[model samples]
Target: MKKRGGIRTAALALALSLSLSGCFFRGADELYAVPQPPKDYEALKVRLSEVIAAGGEYAAPLSGELIQTVQLQDLDGDGQKEAIAFFRFSSDEKPLKIYIFRQVGEEYEVLTVIEGAGTAINCVDYVQMDDEPYKEIVVSWQMSEQVHSLAAYSIGPGEVEELLRTDYNSYKLYDLDQDNQQELVVFRTPTDGPPQAELYDFHGVLGKTDTAPLSGGITAVADGGVQAGYLMDWVPALFAVSTYGGNGTITDIFTCRDGKLENITLDPDMGESRETVQFYTQVTGTDINNDGIMELPQPTPLVDYKITTATPNFWLIHWRQFDAQGEAHPVFTTYHNDRDGWYFILPETLGNNLTLARSDLPGGGERAVTFSYWEGDEAVEPKPFLTIYKLTGTNRVSRASLPGRFVLFPAEGLAGANDANTIYAAEFRDGWDCGLTEDEVRERFAIIKTDWLGNS
Candidate 1:
């Protein structure tokens, strides 16, 4: 459990980014570990300036954290597509180290970076382990504001297992029984109300108090719940697409029998709540031209910053469409997106429910990217951007433009690099390798390459 097997956890994101700003004196005997962006931030800032000249000190290399969940598959069959990072290596106070790998061809090694919850600070995020199939990574940290801390790792090959360490928080991993595996849900705060989802099987010895149900708090992400959506095998019977907050929030899915957490299914009404979700994307429900009955489109409302307000301004974004038996509706949106409003309901047979395809980025406005995430004094960060759109016609959407200057990074303001977990421009294959379906990730992020419409 300690020495070189599974958990080591002690990452030095620029020596906790120069000791979380307070700065310090020589202490880099060796602790480079950097991973993010266009060749992992210039090869970890030139090997962290040679580990700060082998620890002599000059300073200025604290720029990490913007990975938001790793792993891309290819398994290793190798065609290309193996670059995992999962961020938050420093900027202390919480969000301790984590870092998985997959660069191969050019040296980005290091496939693990535990941190096993000592000073706590988790935030990993990932799901899809219904019983035992694949995907299963969760970090979730807080330990206060009503206690929140949980760990559950599971990436293999090079090795990475720890699985389970609850007290729960508002967690989510998805896939509540279409039978693909992937489940783990909680609402562990002070629990003044809704926020109770479960589906345990966390792996190995069973331990960690073990879990079972697949439905309990299908609601409670807070503010009266309303996340509703996501089931593409995020984890076995992993459903938690809320709508209310009364009994456990609006119900929809939730599997895992024998042990508890019921409510097997629901999703026909889908009425209220959207007064303020803000933005979110991810949809793929075939039927293509074959058109029989399938259409689930989402991901279009790029809000890097800037919002039109009549008075009522709301913000929340998240979606994972594909219903009508395809299962997956982890909805959440109240969006305004420069007055776009919102609506997401895919899986009709893809006859074109919406987002046939749309995009923007050839050159329009915002595109710096940094979704933000720190929590604990509650930062939430991430806000710079000018353009990012992808929405065909109907509900088809994708937007961007959040400029006020939208930049922050004193201690690391909008420091969250490139849409970590909240997803941004999904369904791409040539670079991330395999797994594409939201109509092949909106036709590979709606190729524009060189369009018109006020040309880019």
Candidate 2:
């Protein structure tokens, strides 16, 4: 949601001022004057049909078959809401009409008429561009083919002025810099090259931002307005763009700085390739560690390249945090593989109690990996566990489990630790008092291997 610290304050002040005036109040305890009834849809539709029938150059045939979409909002902030309607005259041609209607007592009056809008209307939203109590109307519509257009209009007493217009595929309104004013973030993807993202202020001025080129065309761009942490409070907005091709899928973070969109660099120690094991479709900014700074939660597929058999695919949730200098660092990652299905937990705290352990198969054979959780005092007898091992020289992955033991619960599939060629599990207890040590639990639970092998 767009931040409205200043807009809300102004609205409250306006309500108080109306209450102090001689306006009639419905109730004694009512803080503000009662608002007039909204314009009736049937009445507005009748007025639109009459106006279209009263032929003009802009008039078009109005049939019952044509699709009509209507929305009502107080575009001018006059306490009474206005109606905006879109009429589709033909599906084969790029001809559409948009009508704005105002309510004057029991009758509906035409405020503005926009002819030949486009083939179809995309969306309409009211956004505050400045300190004015009234908001500007933003309309995004399809112009032709893959081309889209966006227009912003300032609606006032019987006057409509177009404030801005541009070509865009998608756009969002957000207070990127947390300056109590919102900026427009527009994205455009060309058929010939990588996608372009632009930031524009309320005054329709474009940002002097620099964007890094990606060889593989851009596949997705996620909006990080709501999840933006402290860093977004300082910049205009935070966004993540994903590109794919010969270089694999690469995800980069971008934010506004010095009136320019700058790319954030990941810490070198986090490895050379920023691409994950699988393609990342979504990226959200969140405070995973509660450090006030925003962290990124990227979900990807989990796979072992050496395995050739049918291995079960699970999701791996990777957490990326940024330092003071805007360098990203990998914090923690984990996954769950229960018999039902695969699951990836986020925010760190949800999967913190789980751990993954690596151990050698009995007789010093192939190495194995297992996911376990701390059972604490609520331990179940004959604990069930699943392990994965690769056959020697075949590069085929196999799954084995201790027969007769119950399967590991989804909550117990958290990753523990892998060290000294050994996988260790932890114990979790309630009330901070289940008297059980990690070593004691490991000693009580003997590592037994069964000859039950199946294709992964």
Question: Using lDDT as the measure, which candidate wins?
Answer: 2
Q: Tens-digit lDDT track for model 1 on 335-444?
A: 22322212222222322111111234454332222222112122343222122232222222222112322212111222442332222232221322222244432322
List lDDT for all candidates, in order. Answer: 0.36, 0.46
The CA lDDT at 26 in model 1 is 23
**lDDT for 251 (candidate 1):** 34
lDDT of 2 by residue, 142-207 (tens): 666666678877655445567678876556676665666666766665677656666677544323
TM-score of 2: 0.54
Among the numbered candidates, top TM-score falls to 2
lDDT of 1: 0.36
